[model samples]
Target: MAGQSKLSELFIKCKSENRAALIGYLPAGFPNQSDSIKIIKAMIEGGVDAVEIGFPYSDPVMDGPVIQEAAEVARNNGITMAKTLEIVKEISGTGVPTLLMTYWNPIEKYGPAKFAHDFSDSGMEGVITPDLPIEEAGVWLATAKENSIHSIFVVAPSTGDGRLKDVTSNCSGFIYAASSMGVTGTQTNVANTASILVERVRNVSGTPVAVGLGVSNRAQASEVAKFADGVIVGSAFVKAVLQNPSDPATAVRKVAEELALGVRER
Candidate 1:
């Protein structure tokens, strides 16, 4: 575990446990600064093998209403890049592999090299830039590689087989397979499209695949666990914290535990 990249260590740990990995996402500053950090720790304690801390952007074109609203709260509360790094550093200290999930535009404005160094310095394992296409990621990849940070790319259901290989080639950790075609949010049922996309990615790269975008409750997590190497719970966790802001940590903890149990069913 110490020898492998943190992301690799997570996959290896999950495999050894005979279960898929559980990844939970939360904006760096959702309800408030104090509650956000507490919520993340609660997530790890509940059973997340890894965490994705969202760097809230004003225009989150790829996010659903739940996540977009969370972004608004974070930004409105004065959550800046500095505050996000502070939160990342604290969460990384929990010994769970932590990755910053953000839009590529923020990295461009912050300078990829500078951002990579800050992330590494903050004890982050890596990053997941959902919007950074492989065609335009050469410099960012180089910067991340230089800092020993893993790069994860999204492999959509619509992606061609050739493009799937291209995207996987740029990925150093695992591939994030959006379960549905639309933006990120919870759905009543896990998308059947994810299994197909995962199979396609497997044909090209052996990297672990995590299904994201629609997973909500434990049953859905169990559904995705059948196919993916990991189950990513984002919008649901964000929604939990958003709904119970006064007790966000407990809300997040309960959801994380459910997702963790679901993954263990495999």
Candidate 2:
């Protein structure tokens, strides 16, 4: 097969149908762990094509204000790596492809090899480590692959051509392309930049590219899907729940529905 299973095949299937996959991200224990699971289940019910379960870490330099706050809330609520895996197991019961987005620190602390085996057993479809560049991916990559866990890589707007090929060469699932130059939550009118990166990644990697990091609205998501296989809505979705003046679940469901509408429309 050209691309591995999990998200890669899922996006290919979606693309064949002339549709873009919707990948939603939410921290494991944001407002609360129980509430987080409920929101996840609701997201699937609301038509999310795939889900990224974020494992909250302390030094998330790439995240924006909203996700940083959500991580803090999760940490304050005592959401550890072990508990997060349990949550992943619970969510996988929904039968949707769910990946774990995390930093390398926790994996280092927990040991990448062991974490890979256990995480796959816990039902994670894949793992996305933005800070773990391809050069540094060794044991973790091998271990994840050995256990059938997809190991994803990220490519940014500033990534050069040669390095772009290196980044996506052995990537298991989809390649996450950062839309802007800055952190995860900042959105700009850089559709052309995103499109360029998407084309470059496709040219080299022949892998599915999902644009993330600043996509917060239906229009933005729709615009991005024009050239990308999928769209990742993160900070905006987290912001929706936090910005809810009244009901947070409603906020999540609303954002989820809007993105689903955006992806399905075109």
Candidate 3:
């Protein structure tokens, strides 16, 4: 028998532990390169089980103000695929599974096969391509599969049952379920549709489901954790980095600790 993929193993571990996984996101080179790496380390040390580091796309259509601003700062700092891979390599050294969240264009520019190979060789476990449609994901999927890297696709409230099935069926990692039909950011409250979507996903697939978008606080994380196998906290953590750029590690640590506690509240 074969062993499990890194992502599947993480979800399985969390499932056995009776709590959702805390997945944290941070844009590489944000606030500055040194601070960005430190921030991610802080979260992992604080309790994050896995990480998604944004590669800073020029057009972040899927992200909200917080992530967009942080990405912009990273871009202005002259971040590139090379730099992002470097960050991923360093972060993965912590033994926490790390993923790169990038738009398809960057992957296209980098050459899908080359990007996947380089990423996997750098010690990262997966890639989350937001804009890559399932219909057009063959090349990316094939390349990732060949490298033993997980490919995660996003499912939204508007995702039809057939599409949901298609997306989830192709998923090697947990399916990324957007809580609401909007860009990512901090929300005043969790989207009611979040639970419904996760339920729908569970009904059709055994792959773990992770809920993201607009999860801002511990309470919201706990609420989503009730239904999701992994609670993804992005914009809120980016906001923490923005608030204390001079020394963001402590602030990011606090946020991750709170979210980790929330995920285990069950």
Give the CA lDDT, 0 to 100, for residue 238 in model 1.
89
User: Alpha-carbon error at 97 in model 2, in Å?
Assistant: 0.4
Lowest summed lDDT window (length 10), candidate 1: 1-10
Against the true structure, candidate 1 reaches a TM-score of 0.97
Give the per-residue lDDT of model 2 (tens digit) for 1-266: 32455566788788888878999999998778888898887777766788899989899998988899999998999999888988899988777888999999999999988898788887788889989998889878888877888888889988999898888886877889988798988868857789999988888876688888888888888888888889998887788778883677777887888888787666
The runs of at least 3 residues in candidate 2 whose Cα sits more than 4 Å from the true structure, single-residue gaps closed, are 1-4
In candidate 1, position 199 carries an lDDT of 89
Q: List model 1 lDDT by residue over 1-266, tens digit each.
A: 22387778889888888888999999998877887898899989888889999999988888999999999998999898889999999999888889999999888998999999998899887789888898899899888888988888888888998889999888877889988788999464565888888889999998899999999888888888888899998999988987886787888899999999999886
Question: Candidate 3: misplaced stretches above 4 Å?
Answer: 1-3, 186-188
Number of residue pairs clashing in candidate 1, backbone atoms closer than 3 angstroms, sequence gap of 3 or more or interchain: 0
Q: For model 3, how does the per-residue alpha-carbon lDDT over 64-182 read when each residue is reduced to its tens digit?
A: 88899999999998888898888999999988989889999989988998888888999888888899988999998888888988889999999999889999998877899999988
Question: lDDT for every model?
Answer: 0.88, 0.84, 0.88
